[model samples]
Target: MENILHSPINNNTLSDFISAKDYTVSGNEFSIKIDEQTGLLITTPRPKAEDLGKYYESDDYISHTDGNKSLFEKIYNWIRNYSLKKKLALVESKHPKGALLDIGCGTGAFLSVCKQAGWKVKGVEPGAKASALAKEKVQESIYPSLFDAELNGQKFDVITMWHVLEHMPDLNATIERLKELLTPTGVLIIAVPNYNSYDALHYGKYWAAYDVPRHLYHFSQQSVKQLFGNHEFELKETKPMIFDSFYVSLLSEQNKCGRKKWFSAFLMGLESNIKAQQTGEYSSLIYILNRK
Candidate 1:
């Protein structure tokens, strides 16, 4: 198990070092590469958190309620509206009804929804407080670490990593382990920010989705597909979560220069939505993949 890095282009930056086609690190059956174009790290076999501090930033984590009341209300309404559509789509899809696992199930909001839908739900989360909150909300056991969690040999019919993959230290290994945990014909759903989206083009590094350090890997559709294809997974479907671009852009603008730029944030969000609707390149995309 050697971690090998590969990139089509090379430079002196760490991003370049990781992305160099010849660069590879070996330890636990994983390799990480940096994409020079996007400045994102890609890994074969996901990385593990030796200590919580490396990944967890208290200030960055948003509560269920945080931003302005209007913005909060709008976001909640959007989430609620989209959740129904997403849940319906999931139910109608080929996904099985057996056990489901949600990796990095933040606050367990999605799990709670799934539970109400009558699916057997379980999760893995790293944040202690968020994990506790998820437990309270879903009343299901949540492992604090994906590396240490016991799967109990129960294969899952559906595994979701909503907005979680970019945060993974070793992306490939995580997906590999997930493949092992999935039942035959099982589906893995992943949602991540799309660096190729129009918002990214306009915002550059200011793009809200690149919640840097926390978002170690900013993936484009091509990169994500390539990552999964190299492994044994086949992409079943790819679609953008259009609204996220607007919301995330707002947050990103607020974080820029250490103060909230309300007008600029709103304008960027508006522009993101317009472009997302016109083109399918939303700020984020949700991919449904099946094991090949």
Candidate 2:
């Protein structure tokens, strides 16, 4: 029943290095092991879900925020929403107006947008507060967990797990479930951080995306393609999330050097994007996949 693989990258919780008052400040140490052949990085001795209690419910989980936001927060949200709209446009282009399911649908932001765009939408969120917030936004019930029996027989044209696949420990089981939930011609969109990106190499172990035990898997482009290929998924397209380089680099700067060097981080992000543009190794990648 062991799901873990080989090789390792030592990392710590963001709170351990960054002076962030918003997030729960636990500096617990952990190592992420890599499977050289598969290019998969696994957090060694995965921390139990319960042991990582309430980490998602912290002040840092801004998706669950209610009411008006600060100017900065609003700007950030605008950027995120704009990015999501573009992402949805890509998905819609492939499978125009079909039943869509968003896994890890926090606050139902994307779900709400999809609904407005005329797609039948459903969401699954594991976080209590986030689920409640999502329910308020979407007409459909937001299931609290991925294992809920309600999703057993349901099928969808699109199943998206944005930046969520890495959080899962049961790789084989998760892939199987995604396949089962897809319609005959369905698409599965999985977005994950790329450990092979220049920013990752720049930040090294201090890469903020390596959120220790919470992010059980650190997937490179090769590893992601390998994981899906192993499970009979044909990667249709590889889309880059351009903003992630800036966001992750800023966080990595904060985490690695114990300060927010915005200019330096911006330069690093720009460089990362340049490298990714030339080499196709983005900081974060959206893999559009279909059953082979």
Candidate 3:
């Protein structure tokens, strides 16, 4: 939902990474290129930010719809509440509970949980349907974008972006905005799928985490650090989202075989975690950061 892609990359900075189909949207194939400098994967021919909305206008876009019509969705809804608690616990462990800002807060479920736990919470969601639903649970203003939030020189103690950064069109600009909104002592928590994880290698292009144009950039632990490191953010710690491996592998199997290879997917998920134990690279990672 950013004004996106005034990339600083040159031809020498890019190399072919992989070719993937937009499984969630257009069904067209897209090339994922690696920025040799940052180790961040960029989608070639990335859709214009203004034209990106239509791609999300699908019933299949799971985040926007809480549809339990399929087994995939049912399992998602079940684990979500538990994951919400776990996410809160992780944040609280690192920072004192106070004002929090959730960027790209889909459905407001996470903020709702935090609000109930006595934290002042606000959300920024560009999706109209999602922002409307989030308003039902979060009492404070739900701004369509950070620019509209109008904090009036106020700053949040903690800010979070759960699997949201990869979708950002203007990465540097977004980071600058975040820095301005955060209190000097505040923390920034970012959760994103790791391209270097074992699951990614196992599934390759079938990796459901590589959700194409929507995920314009794919990150590794190194790439993530480099991004914020360039913007003067300190990397505090990293946590694993263990459930993500199994969930991602589930969809990956379907994409690979055109059917749900439940048993195979389970094996892959298990293998990925086991390997991550040795490599310190999990299927998904939550980076804890603060102003440097």
In model 1, how many backbone clashes occur?
Answer: 15
TM-score of each: 0.78, 0.89, 0.94
Q: For candidate 3, lDDT tens digit of each residue in 1-292? A: 2322323433345778799988876898888888777778888777788888887878876677667788878878889989999999987987888999999898898999999998999999999998888998787778888777476586899999999998888788899899999999999999999988998998899999999878888888888888898889999999899989988898898888888888888888899999999998899999999999
- For all predictions, the C-alpha RMSD in Å is 7.0, 4.9, 2.4
Between candidates 2 and 3, the one scoring higher on TM-score is 3
Candidate 2 residue lDDT tens string, 11-125: 2121121211211245666655556555677776555766654445456455666434665466568778898898789889889798999998988989998999999999988
Worst 10 residues of 1 by lDDT: 19-28
Candidate 2 total steric clashes? 3
- Which pairs of residues clash in candidate 3, taking residues 3 or more apart in a chain or in different chains? 4-169
lDDT of 1 by residue, 1-292 (tens): 2233453223224332222111111212223446755455554323344542443545345532223356556565667557746854674476646688888887777787788877899989878778898899999989887666577576888888888888776666787788878897888888898766776777655555655444556687777777787688899888777667667766666545555576776777678767777777778888889888
CA lDDT of every candidate:
0.67, 0.78, 0.86
Please estimate how well model 1 matches the true structure, expressed as its whole-model Cα lDDT: 0.67
Rank by lDDT (best first):
3, 2, 1
Quote the lDDT for 163 in model 1: 87
Off by over 4 Å in 2: 1-24, 66-72
